[model samples]
Target: MELLRSLTIGQYVPRASPVHRLDPRTKVLATTALLVVVFLARDFAGLGLFALFLGACLLLAQIPLGFVLRGLRPIWFLLVLTLLLQVFFGGTSEGTVLWRLGPFAATREGLVQGLFVTARLVLLVVATSLLTFTTSPVELADGMERLLAPFRRVGVPAHELAMMMTIALRFIPTLVEETEKIMKAQMARGADLDTGGLVRRARALVPILVPLFVSAFRRADELALAMEARCYRGGEGRTRMKQLRYRRSDALAAAVVLAASFAVLLPGRFRW
Candidate 1:
């Protein structure tokens, strides 16, 4: 589906922007901090400040606003569903009712809750997307492994986990491409993937899914063989080709994110 391809999550966009040039570890840490702030935000004022920060980050990254927003297309249904549930089923019974449908009522508190929840979800997605957008799969893996290295003393397989995550992210676009190919092939063979009710359309996907799964397995097997042939082993004693180093820019970026995090909390603290 075209919608699937529009998803920018886990897809790196090569650019000569400050955000992209920052150390991957900085981006990872910054993203995590912002995610925490998103959840901590309690009102529109807090969310608006964070939204402005996010917009600034997007601008610094040189990413088109429309491209960044297109990632939300596939999740529109989920967003709408969440809002509807919060509007009708949320809050106490004492709030002013704005609308009523049968026994369900939309209250003022419910509306505020719905909007806040929706904004949080959107901000979360955008923050995560920014991380993936700026960092390449290899860089992400290296950064993740380094970040988790301290836990190695506790017997955590940090390198292996990071490698698995890298492989998964790297294959997202590949899998999407393969799916598109299979869909086109099926259509060419007179297999209808559209023009049906929800159930029927889902049933129509069987033909495409079967071959896609087979292709996925075949690719995995080939990757395993290639790795084996190259004598690849677990991350024990592994050395990176390009070691990650934090620069002055990275420190500046981290400081900015920290300031923004504090700003996000201030609104809730002061109730302003």
Candidate 2:
């Protein structure tokens, strides 16, 4: 159950909205632009603007605030650890010491570093979460393939790579559900997944892994046979069912992303 629960990464929420309908290429590009700005943000003000942008995107995407925040819960411990490390180990020119206890010294710069670093992480996660929340795996793969199409000249199997990524993303939820079912069955047969030490808990995962692997291989074999029967070859000369095209909405979205990046970089630009 614990491992099953841990596999909750990249779960998509079903929603019918403009954000969901936008060209996946637009969403992917916008997310990438935002991520670049996030890393380029030099101060707290820029980071705060990044957070506001993320919140705005989440709202536009119609994803619940609770769901967006839920993803952060699992990483709370790591965030805390980073905060503590920054608070204690970060110092520029031995700035004003806030406190000293048992060979550990906390300074003003350290405090600033800790809070800003943590805030940056929060903003980054929220931004990326918006993309995953709005775009489906299939569309994302199509977008990726389109974006990487130029690499085909270099003998890169861009389409094949995209297909593999799409399949992996598609199976995450299915595998999670399967693991849950297996866990329930094992529990019915008197297996306590929680009550054990580290080694024992790891050993207990063997049963789950075996079934998961077996089912995965079975699925792969079935897929291969089906493809072969249909005369499917590699990504050569394959056409798309829904050809991705950039629309007015996608153009507007890209414009907004560009504006936001500029806003974060130069807040005084719009002052009149």
Report clashes for each candidate as comma-separated counts. Answer: 0, 0
CA deviation > 4 Å runs, candidate 2: 1-9, 267-272
**lDDT (CA) per prediction:** 0.89, 0.83
Worst 10 residues of 2 by lDDT: 1-10
Best by lDDT: 1
RMSD of candidates 1 onward, in order: 1.3, 2.8
Inter-residue clash pairs, candidate 1? none
Model 2, global lDDT = 0.83
Candidate 1 lDDT score relative to the true structure: 0.89
Q: Give the TM-score of candidate 2.
A: 0.91
Alpha-carbon error at 207 in model 1, in Å? 0.7
Sum up the clashes in candidate 1: 0
